[model samples]
Target: MEIKESTLDRVKRLKEKYALIGQDIDSYLDGLIYANPLTYWDYIEVDSLLSLQKPKTDFPDEKIFIVYHQITELYFSLISHELEQICKNGKNISDAGQDLGWKDNLDVNFFIERLKRVNKYFEALTRSFDIMRFGMEKEQFTKFRMSLLSASGFQTASYRYIEIASTDLKNLVHESKREELWNADYHEQLDNIYWRRGAVVADTGEKTLTLRDFENKYLADFHRFADEYQPINIWKKYQELSAEDQKNPLLIQRLRELDINVNVNWPLVHYRTAVHYMGGAAGDEKGTGGTNWKKYLPPRFQRRIFYPELWSETEIEEWGKSWVEEVLAESLKTEEKLKDEL
Candidate 1:
């Protein structure tokens, strides 16, 4: 015997079941908070965090910059939350009073996985930088550079959070301070927004690096490794370092063999953009926008580093002469050897 319920009756039963499940979920969430009420704010704050963008420029590209930065900050907040949670977990497991059933060694594995996600965000973030640079040709940047009088990305609280986090990890942090003539109500609004979200503005050190310094570091590394064996090796070293328990002496040697490692990609991207957007060798001097722009390096730092032997003027000339003579001799020998073999 088979019994089929009417459509209305079935729909009514489905609704009743969903309502029961919803109540059960709410009850579980409440129990979770009751277990650790001190951590309740983490849940509340996550929801209220990301609504803080106020664009003030009509320069269509400005919104792209603002949104990319906002998205980056949101990722940073997630990273900070994960780091804090991992640290707490580590401390909890080691504490004598509470026997956290979780294995202490597993905490390290969890942290590494969390950090790998952060690195993926960073990879995307650097690409965002590339996209922003693409948006601003020299002239477009100049148009807004003056408007930016005192304002810069370095001043952003999100960037400051990155700086502070880097400092905490014992990395050499550069601090720079430059006075700007312009200030905006948006700046005040940013402060107010932080308070509204119940988060404090990050205390960042002054900007210690200039555009020239940034260029020099990239250029120097590019020059140092322009004629290296392969760029892929550097990429490999970066992957090794990112792993949960990676330890290999060969990778370390490879890292030293390639001076810049992962950072080499940024300079490479910049050069590629110049070559594509600014036009090849001929258009180097002519600004992509209206402002004057320099030619991307003839071969570029990365190329030079990857192919150092080719760049040596004295060696190149000698090698060119010897190569021709050797090729001719080898051709003659090949004919003679073929005849003898026959």
Candidate 2:
């Protein structure tokens, strides 16, 4: 068959492209002739993805729990991806423990766009958490959870990476110790990241097995990632922008939204959901032998603000305070109804 003029023109351009790399265009064309057409199923690995839910127990709801967490981590990975892109163009920390070179190809619009994407992911996760909250029978959840041993959603590394990539290391220190640890050494700062507060033994101060395992696996990587992004984290990059760009209303709005999304809304959803599933014991149900989710998951308790300078004093003080009260009131009502039924 005669080749169409359009096809000949395309092939001519393709030959030039391969000639630049000194490759035989005809050889590549021959391979394409023998290649199978791609299918959506093979590309997405649908069968392998569906087979991932190997629930440890026969409890049907356990599969829901497993799949939901997998989806959440996937979202966390997306959030981290955007953050890494934002920081990629900025100067990295050096062996001297400070970013030395001045290099930034960052666009303010790019910053806002990526932060908006991160906010959307968090918003979607918050909305979908109801799936986990109401998806399982409380009887089944409570029973199946025991089979999980020290495993807990609190061990999510991508979520921790989100926090580390969002701001300076000092901001993640527990509020009560922020001032004391703000000037502390790097290892000390890592040791005091606020999440550790939730993983301590209640009576004797010791890390829970879940927290220990997490630290063993992730603590080194966390330090390296934090150091690499120290000079270019979202908050630090925001600080380094020109005063005019810093004052951009939309930019500020996106940053503040990110702060609230990660620090307040995300934790609050887990708090309320824990109340629904674990009931009053949710307060006591922190990762095994730890301070409990109530202590860790409540924004009012941690008061961990990322962009503190962006918020007014009153806004910072009242942050997550009202939401805590509302959730507690709802929890009380839930407990009363359970008592009445019993």
Tell me, by TM-score, which candidate is best: 2
TM-score, each model?
0.37, 0.84
List the candidate 2 regions with Cα displacement exceeding 4 Å: 1-9, 16-22, 90-104, 185-187, 281-287, 323-342
Give the Å error, residue 230, model 2: 1.6
Clashes of 1: 17
TM-score of 1: 0.37
RMSD of each: 18.0, 9.9
lDDT of 1 by residue, 1-342 (tens): 555668657756655654754644455546767895466658767546545545565565656656766776777677555534443344444333444565443244554455445445555655766676576555554454445433433234443333223211111111111112113222222222211111112232222233233333343342232223112222222343435334332322222222221223333444455555555456643332222223222222212122222124653333322343343354456546656876
* lDDT for model 2: 0.81
Error of 2 at 240 (Å): 3.1
